[model samples]
Target: MPLFVAQYPIGINSHVEAIILQLEIGSDDVCMLGMYGPGGVGKTTIAKAIYNKILDHFEGSSFLENVRDKSGTFDGIIQLQEILLRETLGMNGQLKVCSESKGAIAKENILRHKKILLILDDVDKLYQIERLIGGFDWLASGSRIIITTRNKHFLQTLRICHSTYEVKELDDHEALELFSMHAFHKNKPEEDYSNLTDQVICYAKGLPLALSIIGSNLHGRSEIEWKSALDKYKMIPDKDIQKVLQVSYQGLDETEQDIFLDLACFFKGIYKDYVVDILNSCNLYPVIGIKNLIDKCLINVDQFNKLWMHDLLQQMGREIVQQESPKIPGLRSRLWCYKDAFEVLTENKGSDNIRGITIISPKLAKLQLKAKCFEKMGNLKFLLVGNVDTCGDLEYLPNGLRVLDWSRFPSSSLPSNFRPHNLLVLDKPQSPVILDKIFEFRRKLEVPQNTKYEDNILMDSHSHRKLSHQIDYSSKIDFSHSLIKPLSTLHAFMMDSIMDYEESYNIIVTGKKIPKWFNHQSIESSISFWIGPKFPTIAVCFVFHLVPLKDSYANNDKYGSIHNDEICWNCHVNIFTNDHTQPLTLQRDFYSMKCDHLWFYSNSHSKFQRFFRNMMQGDRNLVEISCKISWWSSRNKKFAPVIARMGVHAECICHPPNSVIIDDNSDYFENVDDSSDDN
Candidate 1:
């Protein structure tokens, strides 16, 4: 048999010793060992290592690769027989698969008396292996057979397998060494890449194939390139590794495949029983499908009975969904990412192809929901949202929904026409829609420290959104849980300000145009608005296009894409009464954005019970806002390498007394040039 090549063979000696011990070469009884693991965990590599290490001990040996790839038909099985016989017995190339127990005892007896070692690699279906090579009775005493499969159950049930070797993922140290060998041409990462190396290892999660492919993909790349590649891999996994892992997934039936994808997209880490219940409601036959997934090593149930999947496999599933409709998320069967879900609902782009959606903790301060958003999502069976601020109550819902777990539902009751006949889980945690107390503050509002203002202003879908909970009111959302996110919120400054202000405006950039709601508009770099008793409190909002920073290092093809937690654009909103006075600047902070997006420094809660009454008393003082955007790292942001790329002027709007209105529509937006671009 031609020897198999084991790439980056780390930790193979122990495996070879274990397999050889299981074989028991000196024993009188012949043995067949089953080797199993998920794809890319190095099952084939270990088998090859075992084969090369012990081939000298046996008189005849054969190592057959990719039995799964060639087992599609009886002809393929016959081909596998030919290779096995030719390698083990020096027989002619022609061989036939036995239709019954040992086809032609004369042919089978050729190896029955010879002490041989044989390996069948990548066997998906056990029946194929059984038909190609019968039980150990056909082999001589002291002979050994080792068969490898992705499905552990295949080995567990096969009585002929005297022992089974469950090949586990590489340990951290070995994984790092193997990865660095490909990534840095050394046994360890370069001096300054310890953290980056750790991140790669963590994401790869000990899968040898992922390590090798990702390492090679990032080879000779700069730190920035590594970061970019890592970010992209999360969104779209390594194509080669994905291909290797998808073989097992493709072996599943249609319903099993759906269950696997569902778990990958939304159910990972959820209790196994809970997942089975939800999937059962969808008529997916979850009991059997989940079992199939477990048997195939697609998912695992931990001690708590929660489902866990390999990170690469989960990413691969999501990428499969994304590939269905690369440019339009609405056309895909599932939606989990906040950006994709937000875009589909806000743009009214939902389609019947979408089967489920889970939108959690949207990056926007307030997410305004309209009733018509789900009009086209007739096939949507699962919907879950948490920490989402919506304008008002939902007016409609489909009857086919099997799961509806929405936090912060804005209505006092479910839609009048909506029915719960098909509902399985109606989860509403800390919801205030049942008996909410809607209170109106005095036109003058003062926010005390350690107190939360209502979020109505942020959720209002009308013309006058309230400052604090302008309309949607339950709890105040805080960014305190995150390290870098605090630098992006107005609440960071609201609690400690020396002077009491009625309102605070947080900045966000999206692929949305500026709404035509502000009374005063400007086309220049700055805007002036008059605030009076009729409209004392105000919030600044605008949109700016992202133009490239000239001669900046972060202008490569993948530079615009980055981890939101690590990088951001520092924007300054300077407020001035006139040119002679120093501006009362909105404290400098960072917000994540994309190049095609517009900037909107919008949403605030609470009425300023106190304002610059002295400054506002005469001549209807015009509050001038000058906004500029620059790129910066979340780390050492104060000393950021600034690139002045955008200058946007925002129009200020006053909140009314009773009801709040916020129009998140695409209208009356005048595009301002991103002056930072070389163009």
Candidate 2:
């Protein structure tokens, strides 16, 4: 028989002692004992202590560590077979899984032993127990199965004939004793600091983990240092484990410490692969660095690849990061919700102070931007906005703003004054207000009337080479309940401003239903007469689907590639691509049909043409927009010939309103000849 690790058995409290003493002895019904508590609360520790004390009476015993961390579906069966085989049958290496046809393996193994002990520790779910030992009539008359778990409800639902015991924090005396041994290196506190010791114990809150950590941290430290440590407890709001845990955290390496802080301060409920990607991107990997982090007990990787940290540990990490480098208030920070963000922005007009901004959620109410911060940020660039509803209004834009992106916020209507010439890319992803507003605004801008009208503006089936580029990166999505509609309007206004003022534009719109205002006529006319003067070519691409290549977004490599069917109607052309990387098909049309314009329209809820704008150059005088139902894409093909185009710029660049000739009684057909002759 193997010798098990010895544990402290003296001073066992009545709560745990009573439960242990009530175990069924010599009963025909199998005896089961369940211990449950919160994570890191000593459920597993206590179970081992009790099991070792009683194992002498048992013919066999086995302990399973971290059964909750198993990965596959067969973890329960494999665990059960291993425990029964080794403990009951004394099976060593080269064990075989007994097939179901050779059933009763568990019963046979257990029946062979008179008294046995089986400990299943860290049982996360009830299915683990039911699959492992529920139906097995394996135990002899005096045998016992001891189970330990964090979830109390799991034990109750097990339907086992087991006595349940809830483990709690140690009392003050026991906690003091534990703390003194670790901190003072003795069973009692030193005479010089006895008073401070008591206060430390009080802050430790009778938690065994807390006592051990604080004790280990304070060992051999000076009296003044001890007093400072004790006083620091007052600063801790959740006086459970954070203060005590901080002592242990001081010993970790810079890298391990950094990984810890990132887990705590930035990402939670993140999968392992995603964290790996981020860590790798930061060039933080060293030999066995992550595994060493796990071994140090700074981080915990669960069976499902999810990483978790203790609340205290998380707080400690956040503090470390904050202390090292506090985020500047005016620097760009990703925003998640509109109300909270607007509240912050509204309180401080950070528009001037903030160098860059990215808003993820769409709901920005009017008051959020009222802050005086905007006036201070004169060098601001890269504003990414999203999560707005269709009718939301656009707030005022800060001057010197570059890269006005709306892929995050989709809108139906555009504000009139949103003209940013330096703007380079616009992605609506759900609204056509950009194209519509541009068509309407161009007519309102009224091109000089002396330029000659070009006849080759209408698009057929043309191919044009279009450039692609990525835009500003941000993860903040607006989560405000009040800003959904307003945010949409805000996006629409910005996108419209781009179309009205900027030359060189790339717009992405996504939706399943077309907007009521975006008709076939608008698509045709905008592709022709409404193309911008400085940059006339546009490529319209549609993203038919968006499927995540991986299950998580935190990973950069895990991405959903955009699939687009790019069309250049001006030159009556279609782009053919084996990979769809470069949609120069529209560029082909720009040269072939002598058309330098493009317009895109789709049903509501489409994400087409996003990739094209994402790949554009930052220096280009362009606008990237997303709208409710329509978008535009255009790029001059390298192969397209530049024509010396002559045009009498129309007074109104957009479609002109029809008015009757004042003095002539000419019929409609006769009037058409006169108009053709004038052209």
Candidate 3:
């Protein structure tokens, strides 16, 4: 059989071959070699392979496996030292070593003159190495020492093991061969099981332990049996592989265990800073806890600072949670499964044990909820309830709630007595009832009066209900392109063009954000940028949030909320050709807005040719142009600064000169507390 444990360690990993090249077996100095990666990645096999190849050159050698588990304490260290002395000295009985003396007597008596080869396999802590081979001054020159570990930092901390190499997972080709060796007893998969083998490879994600265990289990089974087993493994992983991968997790401390399980269960692929904020709010000292987890090779941080772990590790953590309350999910600490969350909220089966919950069903089903659906859960910390279609208002939310992201929230306002002093994030991106205002602000342009708009509102924690005008993303507005909401990408600004403009795509290079950002800082902000003579197609995209629309009278709430639904405001878009006071107006102001919208005004190449012809009729050379958005009350009264994310795009152009010259002339109007609309 070609099983890895039974057969010679050949063709199992490419990293083994690469590492063998760096061993320098014939070198004249003591070489310290270290190999590190997550558990079950074949570190032991590679060490054995190198040891066997170079053992003939050494006077004596020994390969000690599982040193981390074997040499944990002083008593354990003495036991391991006795074994090391017996094997390397070619002795038949126990050596003279004690827990109090450590390896002091053995180092002098056993290895005073001979050149030796020593391999410490799976060494997690430093004591294992210190006791087994202390200082290594006793062994003769040209001797070699090797250590294999799951923790890279464990080896990195030792100056002796400076030549550490990271042993990553297998590539697609290597993974396939490794699986085939165990299943088919050959170099490749059976002809009939090619696609199934590919699926297995994808599931294993190149973890050798998973591949071998799963492949061996499915060997000699019929095609139907293979299909059934694969389906079964989707929900329930194999016990053999889980046992091996969970070893690292089982070694963590209590707080580190909580941090690891939390990341593996809920925060995989989430930004590190955001995860830290959420976990720190729960009193989990995540800074040192996360470092411990990394040192153990249980988790990793990607280039973008997102936390991710091996798929098997993540599955293992979820399995641990499932075991916490196998039949009851609400009794568990965290809930991300939609069905579990739906049952807890719908049946009110939640308890104070529930710390965090998220219900993001793939199909987006609306669960009917009572006014006090979350009353029983008193210790709830974070909630991301989605699409609760209810008639009456929500009565109570846990005062301990910290992060609230309720999607499609039906109520016009939060619970009457809900105090969010501990709330860090209260985000309701597209909830229809956050604010009950239909403020549609646009340029001064005439349109039909009968235009339907979604109701949008904004409120603050410090003020009472106040309705304000919002933009309606309907066809009645003077927009040349279709309206799309929730683009979902941060800093996503690009011009989608129709015609080919690659012929003249040269742009001046500058070190700034193109189509510069003027959102979130002011109600109205303007910028000027230099445009070429041949104006490429431009796309104007903006993200505006008038939710809890701020007013002059409301004491700027910490969470920036305002009471009332029907907010009244007008948006003014003016263009300037290097001018200070007057505007080159080509459109009219739009009235009545209703929701937080991401407005993408796309223009065809022909439309761009015609637009520049109209706006810049006289001065058509390469010049700086400015676009401004000003917000005023419907009755021409000045309003608070409108906060929105606006980005300018030129689709066919790859690079453009960026400029951000903000002009904020919003000091003329007084704060308006007169609620009586005199329009």
Candidate 4:
């Protein structure tokens, strides 16, 4: 038995027992077992322990170490084959199996009769197994083959493993013990050093290899030295540990590696599906690449489908980019450090190699850059600047940008010649840019007519309805020339609403009245109207006029008698039958310093229509639509916005229920007058 198996102090007993049970090692049946996890998670250590415990029972055994690394060399597979053959057959000299065919012959003729225990350590590829033992039939009964790898997909592809176990990081107790064993050369830390020891363990984050390496490196150091080391680890990880963890990253192909680096640099903690869409638009083959990364333990997706990477791995990725240009931020492939990005922008030190940059600093001083700072960064794809006050013309932006999430962009409008056709996300929440420029940009943008929404409509239950006859109010309102055009970018706002219905449609503009196209209008916050039976289309529009205040007043006070830019309004719309049975409700948040109008439409086949039909089943003849508005100060939550004016418009396309004569030019609901009810 290996001495380390007995001497290894932390967690492994449960893992060993579980693997033994999963493999059914006690039974006399041929089985294959796999131990898989991220690099430095002790996959190899556990496999060795299992191998040592059961070596006495097998007639022949061979442990192939570093198979992933050695297999990359010339004839590496044949060399591994020879080791397996020599050990299992008890041969003194090398075998004659130079080629794959000879190796198959050797396995069939000699090793078939022997009961063997073979452990392939750090195996990464399928060909390594196929070129070595070939199959379980090549060995005698009761034989067990164990493989250790960083990727579980490798075992899945081979289909040889009867069972696979994922090796997890140590718990807090075990991690402290293991770390103390090396740091203090004891099982527990001294009473005076307990706090510092806990800090180290927390930084290690339960990774056994990191705890071991860090403990060993900091052994016999003073308290001051320990603090300095921990601080240093935050900025630059230990080179020894980084090298071990980077092997899995290096195993990825070029495109997979790019996805990994991007996640590490920019997208960590973001929703996984959203990241996939962005990367897929970049032509990165994200679906397969992300799967491989997860299999290799390079990244993880939580239950909420958010991407997460270990802190050590994230640091290692940033370090790799840092090495590209030790002093020059412009030469690096990605930049996330606040100081580095600030310097790159202010000094106009951008290069074509810079693919992505993110600057988020709440404490950094204001910065101003020239218009041509990004002119040379032709390959830039992702750019995000947050919290920092950046002032520049932004005359030159990379044409191939996929995401531009610059909050507080100083320019009034993007350059006329600048192209945004490749953009997947343009998130400028508090930007002062004019909406007309955005409308023009959207007009120039190429949108695929056959989008997934259209496909969904075709496949829906209302496929029999003629979608062509559905009225599209957006087409009739010349967005470029409309009065409301200055208040909102119609295309981008609509696209955002279509993408995520829960999120608010925010825009900054100045207006006081609803558009004239709406047939029905009211000045109250809440409006109720009666809907007849034959109405095919129903549209509701709400207009809000914002009152601006000084920055200090908005920031200092939480709740006052008036509303300002700091207030966030919660808007709700509900529809019910005449009997007060609710059929539909819509809620959204409204924020910004400009006047804006929110519009909602329901056609013959829309969800509202379906719900209305179901709710008004049998002989229900009347429907009531109600709109309500309330606001609270986002900063204090106690203050409410004072409504300058709130307007609602309800338009019905078809005739009233009992009206016999239908005039194309006459209003459908003009004769049915009802008092405005405010809630």
- By lDDT, is 1 or 4 better? 4
Mind giving the per-residue lDDT tens digits that candidate 3 earns over 101-208? 646665656566777888888887776676677665666777778889887767767756348777777788888988898888898999999999999998898887
lDDT per residue for candidate 4 within 1-679, as digits (tens), equals 2425434547887888888888776777888887888888888788878887888888888888899877776587778878888877777776766686887788777657878889999998887776677766676788888899999888888755478889988999999999989898898997878999989888888888899999989889999999999999988889889999999988889999899889888887665666776788778999899999999988998774667888888888888888999988899999888889888888889999999998877464577889888998999998887667887687888888877777667776667677766665665644544433432222322212221110000111121122212212222222232221221111112111212221212232222222333444544444444455533344445544222222333221111113332344545667676565555776544433222233333322344455666555343245555555533333333223333233323344333333222233554334321111110
Cα lDDT computed for each candidate against the true fold: 0.62, 0.45, 0.59, 0.64
Candidate 2 weakest lDDT stretch, 10 residues: 464-473
Off by over 4 Å in 1: 90-107, 159-161, 362-364, 433-679
How well does model 4 score by local distance difference test?
0.64
- The best-first sequence of candidates by lDDT reads 4, 1, 3, 2
TM-score of 4: 0.71
Error of 3 at 424 (Å): 2.2
lDDT of 2 by residue, 1-679 (tens): 5434323322345644676677755465678887865444566667766776677777777777677655134644675555656666666765555652233455465554556777888775776655555453655677788887655555667665778777766778887788888887677898997898888777655667667767777899999898887677544433446554564355457776656655564334444553554454334572345665554445667764556665556656655543432444333332323543454454563534343454555444323343133445555554555554323345445544445555423234444554454444444443334443432223432322222212222111111111111110131122232211122222332322112122333444332111121111111111122222233233333222111112223111111112221111111223221223454322211101111222232111112234344444333322222212122221221111111111111212344223212122223323321221121
What's the true lDDT of residue 674 in model 3?
A: 19
Worst 10 residues of 1 by lDDT: 489-498
Report the candidate with higher TM-score, 2 versus 4: 4
Identify the leading candidate in terms of TM-score: 4
Candidate 3 runs further than 4 Å off = 1-13, 73-75, 91-103, 159-161, 386-392, 433-679
Q: Give the TM-score of each candidate.
A: 0.63, 0.37, 0.66, 0.71
Query: For each candidate, how many residue pairs have backbone atoms clashing (under 3 Å)?
Result: 24, 108, 45, 0
